[model samples]
Target: MTILTVNTKAFRPLGVGMRQMIALLGALLGVMLISPGALAGGEVRVTVQGADGAGVEHAAIVLRGPEDAWEPPSDNEATIDQIDREFVPPAISIPVNTRVLFPNQDDIRHHVYSFSSAKSFELPLYKGMPARPIRFPQPGIVTIGCNIHDWMIAHIYVVDAAIHGLTDAEGVWAAADVPAGRYRVEVWHHGLDEERQTTGEIRVEPGTEVDLEVSVEVASRPAPRRRGTVPGYR
Candidate 1:
């Protein structure tokens, strides 16, 4: 069992109320739930490419074993930064039940909200960090948008795989130290023509490199005539 202890004395002086205290405790629990798990696995690399054979950045990767096999989340908390009226990193992949923090670095305020079924939340217009982080208790895609700026958008991928990560600018995701066995891989992109795509079972051998490539059909995004020229872009 996981025990969450809060320093009541820490918040006592701040005049933080009961509701805020509960949110703080929930965030603490999210951290505990994602502690590293027991997995004596080998290394695995995944390469994600678009239809045109271009590196697909920010693609969510999921590798799993049998149906009964599973692993705990890899990290406790993550940040989705807001800069230049855009969501930095555009998209991110996190383990289920991860708490995310959004800090507005821009001078102007933004009202961030998401109506996705997995996690629905609205952070009223603000300029700095919110009172508490938003906790995602379910596994699914959460679409984030700014009410003030229609162009401001982002996606969060919450997965239940044994191990999960996002592809780099090179369309590559390297998963280190996974058990040497057959595992299924799944890839997701916010621009995908479909919800997501997957690869067949890949056999991982001890002391060997396993390379796999995935092709996804992502909708094309038109480029702006010039920077900060979008209708609602600042």
Candidate 2:
């Protein structure tokens, strides 16, 4: 039930980074509220691809069930590191209320911030771990980036539902032993426009695996973020 809003006037322009953040937030929220089905146990295997048959990576998936069927938010802690001036892993899925640590593995300091409505905060330039981890208290997409490194970006998919994950190298995402029930699946990718996509009335049953395939037409991926020496590092 917690959402954070931040001002970005002191940092980068509002036109670019916020576009993806807002798009993702809308995607997660729009589908998560759909009416859920009977709760029960099972597995779901999903595949995302382009119409041309290429696997889509970094796509997020969430299975939305009724509030009555919702489990307590998870307390597990996760970590995303800064290495080679990049956000390692780039994207991740975590249950609502999960604490996440962002440790600087690189030699120089970097500033981290997010303007997403789901969870917004800023970590000023620092070279090591912050004194405390950031907790995601709501269900939505949180896009975080470095003020010192414009090209450095990452995503945190904070979900209230029990099952969620990002697609892999082969455009595949899966979850097992979750409450077996009928759910509407929400899918989103950065490559797509602001309009998010939803596909499936998928049902997960005990001792069974449900496989889903979804396709979307998207623009080509943007150029990789830049990397270089700051002021005083060897």
Q: Output the number of the TM-score-best candidate.
A: 1
Every candidate's lDDT:
0.72, 0.72
What's the TM-score of every candidate structure? 0.75, 0.72
| Structural RMSD, model 2 | 16.8
Candidate 2: give the clashing pairs. Answer: 40-180, 41-180
Q: Cα lDDT for residue 38, model 2?
A: 18
**Model 2, position 166: C-alpha lDDT score:** 88
Worst 10 residues of 1 by lDDT: 1-10
Per residue, candidate 1 scores C-alpha lDDT tens digits across 1-234 of 011111111212233354356556768877432223322344677777776667778888887777535654546798999998789868888887788999999998999999988899999999989778898878878899998888788899988775788898788898765766877777777676544565667776544456777677752232423336666455
- Give Cα distance to truth, residue 220, candidate 1, Å: 7.2
lDDT (tens digit, per residue) of candidate 2 on 1-234: 001111112222353356446656767877432222312346677777765667778788878875536664567899999998899889998888999999999889999999988899999999889888999998778899998787788988887777678898777897766676678777766565642455646665654567777776753243565565444332
